[model samples]
Target: MRVLGVDPGLTRCGVGVIESGRAREIACLGVGVVRTPSTDELADRLMAVAEGVEGWMDAHRPEVVAVERVFSQQNVRTVMGTAQVSGIVALAAARRDLPVAFHTPSAVKAAISGSGRADKRQVTTMITKILGLESPPKPADAADALALAVCHLWRAPMSDRIAEAEAKAAQLARNHRARLADAARERGSTGGQQR
Candidate 1:
């Protein structure tokens, strides 16, 4: 699938595109900060980010967009801003009818480096190695976006398996509950109540 990965930020949203499959082809496409002048209003900054993401969608026309899921942390302000930026990115993808998927930071790290706690350097190194690139993608955010794409690709199959397993488990639990209910009904009909 041709996927566009976005690391959203009001000041600098990182975007990357890659074609993932047996061949594992990657195209950095472009990566740069979308800056809104410091004097600009917050709404303007958000608009700039939205425009940047929309421009990317127009250029890439990707099959799907993968975005990093925002997590609440100690810095509420930063987390809130990131969440807003992420919404803008998601909205851009939805506007184009592109499927959007979110991957958590730990999932991205583990998919790229075999460990959820992997450091930034390790993530960049693994992304470069997996993509067989001569140099790491510039700026940590860009590398992170690429990593998020890779993570989604790696996780998709597993997600299907997990869903199937959960469905089976749920079915089994329902059957067991039905059996218990039937037994209770039988006991009640026989007037054999137990304390």
Candidate 2:
């Protein structure tokens, strides 16, 4: 599976593309940061971000997009910008009909490292080892994006299975309800004939 991981920030959104093999090996296809100047107007910045993300999607053609779920921070403005950037990333994926998955920071850390509370350095180090990179991806944001992709790669199989099971259960329930309705209709018709 090919995944594009997005660590969305207004000033520097990170984008990473990775391919997961059947043997559970992860290969980093690409990694980069999309920078928008703080001096730019909010609308321009957003547009730049949208274009940057869309360009990545077009270039990599990833099957899935994994985005970092925005968490509330003390800085409301920062959180809001992050949320907006994340939305743009998701929208870009949605435009291509790609599946999008949101992974929490803690979840990414836990999946890449052993602990949910692992620090940035630890996560980066582990990511480097996992991908057999000579060095950690420059900028913590880029590494985070890679981690988000890896997390989704690891989790998607089980997640897909669970979704399939739920769908099957729902279908069975619907069929059962249809049968019950049919039986009720037959009983009602017979009762009406006796009137």
lDDT of each: 0.83, 0.93
Best by lDDT: 2
lDDT of 1 by residue, 74-187 (tens): 388778878999998888888888889999899899888999999999999998898777898878888888888778777876998999999999999999999999998998
| RMSD in order of candidates | 3.7, 3.3
Kindly report the root-mean-square deviation of model 1 from the true structure over all alpha carbons. Answer: 3.7
Model 2, span 50-76: residue lDDT tens: 999899999999999999999896499
Distance (Å) between predicted and true CA of 101, model 2? 0.9
Q: Which candidate is the best by TM-score?
A: 2
Query: TM-scores across all candidates?
Result: 0.80, 0.85
The reply for model 2, stretches above 4 Å from the true place, is 165-195
Can you give the lDDT of residue 193 in candidate 2?
Answer: 100
Clashes of 1: 0
The TM-score, computed over Cα atoms with residue i paired to residue i, of candidate 1 is: 0.80
In TM-score terms, candidate 2 sits at 0.85
Instruction: Report the Cα lDDT for residue 73, model 1.
Output: 71
